[model samples]
Target: MEMFGKTLCVTFDDLVGSGVMSKANYKRYVREEKFSFMQRGGNGRKVLIIYDKLPDKIRTEIDTKNPGAKDKIKKQQINPMDHRLKSDSKAVEFYKKYTPKISLDRQTEYVLNVKVLNAMVALEVSMRDAQGKCGFQNNKEIREKVIALCENLRERYRHTLPKARLMEKYAAYKKYGYAVLVNGNSGNQSARKVGPMEGRLLLKLKRSKFPVYTDMQIFEEFNRIVEERNARATREEDKLKPIASPQTVINYLYKTSIKLWWYGVVHGEIAFKNEFMPQFDTKLPDMPNTLWYGDGTKLNLYYKEYDKKQKRMVARTIDVYEVMDACTEVFLGYSFGAENFLTQYDAYRMALETWKVKPYEIVTDNQGGHKKPEAQYFFKRICHLHKTTIRTTASPKPSKALSDASRCR
Candidate 1:
């Protein structure tokens, strides 16, 4: 017999349309013979016999035309033990072994049903436990405990009971406060409310009765209050004002010790009384031509000087002496000097020449330059010849003349 060209094993429906296989005797033929059939438009609609195994004669014909055709066809033969075929066979085997065994005892059947129901409950409980202690909450110990607990239940009941059924029993027992599992859950407590003392303090502050103080000041006062309370045998039941320390009061008033010292000096006020303090408040003696205030002061020369090295340097010294009217603080006359006492006589002469009316009094300090023979000769001889009275005053304590000059400035 001649073989068809490259025969393909196709279902009858694939060739003659799907429903055509169900019509007439086609389904019967396929089921009975275990055969697949194909229809192709060849030699007036011939039916080709497509088999699981081809006849050896036709195989030989195919091999003659294509040398490797026989080996290819033999290799394509489906093996009973192949993985895909074996998987389907195993599934069928499992179903036969574990499918409902009918005609058993009704009580046995009911027990099995209860076990299955418990198994489902246990599974749900196990999942809930895991979710409750998930590592997503960042608690490693809790998650491990949960996993270990579930696994232990599985291992303990592995022989006669399902893991799910045991977990259900375990959870039910735990719900009744059995010691099956130790709970590691923790909770935070609510914070306590403020006490009466704090509330009272806040109320006082709100009412503006409490003095406004800086943090340091408040801390200092708190310490002082604590010390005072500790020293007392009986605690005072009244609200106490914060005691101020001498040092603290001084610091709060003047800010620094140096500032306090400066204030006392400039205002002529003493922290403690002195003899002169009382003397300053007393009256002074009255004497004509008995006292005079004289002073020497230096001035800045706004010029440069030249050195002996033939380099230019400005002269930088100018000094002045002044005589003043004691009663009126009037500037009598003044003289400038590069060297001291060079213009002392000139200063005196200027004073005499400029006085609108000359007084009998000529008073000055007892400096040797002022009382020198030349100075004395001029004052005594010239003033006596002109009938001008002269007298000298002794220097007072702390040189009131200099103090007065500084004050004038």
Candidate 2:
């Protein structure tokens, strides 16, 4: 017999085991020296024959008997669950389980400022649907009710809500609401309406009770208020405001103004009127070589001197003095010394010899050495010989003279 369109053959042992051909038939076949047989194909019956090796003629006979057996084998059906569909609903379930819910209180405050609660609601619905959860599709009525609640909160608290805080709240609400709705059961009927406190309402409280608060101070206060408020209540109706008075504002303004004025007075302007204003009515007559500016400054200093005998060191100080032409800004004379009048006279003599110029006036600050009677007499005699005059400023403002020289340079 044949099944599945394939010829069937069974061994002698197989025939005995299946109780088809008996032992006598098997023995008879063995004595005849023939071990193979063929059975016709029929209803659910498989025929078996025995052969040491299939002969070419038998193989050809089998192929001829079953024309389309290979095609039948290729056409078998596979199990449906074996292949994975990429766009399956499993991803939606995974996200719904892990994503966080938004704070309702925060969202309500945000809606108050933006006045776009309906758009926020729509966004929430869309996000939920994308998560593979049945969105706000319970009915049009429920959606409208939720949207209306957002609008009501906005209307009631619009004045109290800060624009920036409200915006942050809106974002939080949108995110959390979407997560909650996606994972929550619609039929459980917990009044799909979430309140403001549940939404994590953020407070953009005023920077301070005083008007003079800095940005950092204001932010600190705002954070403090938000944390405090959150700790007390999760409901909008339970929220409280810290009181402030007008007197506080006035006091802050007054104090800030006084501080600013004091700062300006301490750090500003210290210059001669003549130095700043060139067109001042009181102008001094030009003195040419008659007047000069003299000052002393440190070039570089040595604190210790090498000791050759002891192979050690000793301390000493050095000072330098120079007289400059007030108009020409030329260095008239300079001296290095630990002594006074002698150095001054030597520097003067060097100036005359080097520049071949004589000064009509000698101007010097009232240092003990320069103001000595002997020095003054020497300067007067020098000025007389040069046909110049002597003049001196009451105080030495070297910085002003230096600035003038720099501008000319």
Candidate with top lDDT is: 2
Q: Which digits, one per residue and each the tens of the lDDT, describe model 2 over residues 1-409?
A: 2212123343333445555457886678656856554432247434345332345654454446555643453343111111111232432443333323224544333233333433445544654464333112434433444444444555554524334454455555455332222323322223332222321111111211334454345434534564576577767655533213222222232354222322222223333223332443523336656555566666587688887987888875788877777667778888897437877787787777787767776666556387777887777766653212234222232233223322111
TM-score of candidate 2 versus the correct structure, residues matched by position: 0.25
Question: Model 2 segments beyond 4 Å from truth?
Answer: 1-290, 301-304, 307-317, 384-409
Q: Which TM-score value belongs to model 1?
A: 0.23
> Cα lDDT for residue 1, model 2?
25
lDDT of 1 by residue, 285-397 (tens): 36422333455677665567777776767577778877665566668777887324556666666766887445444555555376566766666643432222243222222
Q: For candidate 1, list the clashing residue pairs, or say none.
A: 304-313, 304-314, 305-313, 305-314, 306-312, 306-313
Q: If scored against the real structure, what TM-score would every candidate get?
A: 0.23, 0.25
For residue 139, give model 1's deviation from the true position in Å. 70
lDDT of each: 0.41, 0.45
Q: Pick the candidate with the highest TM-score.
A: 2
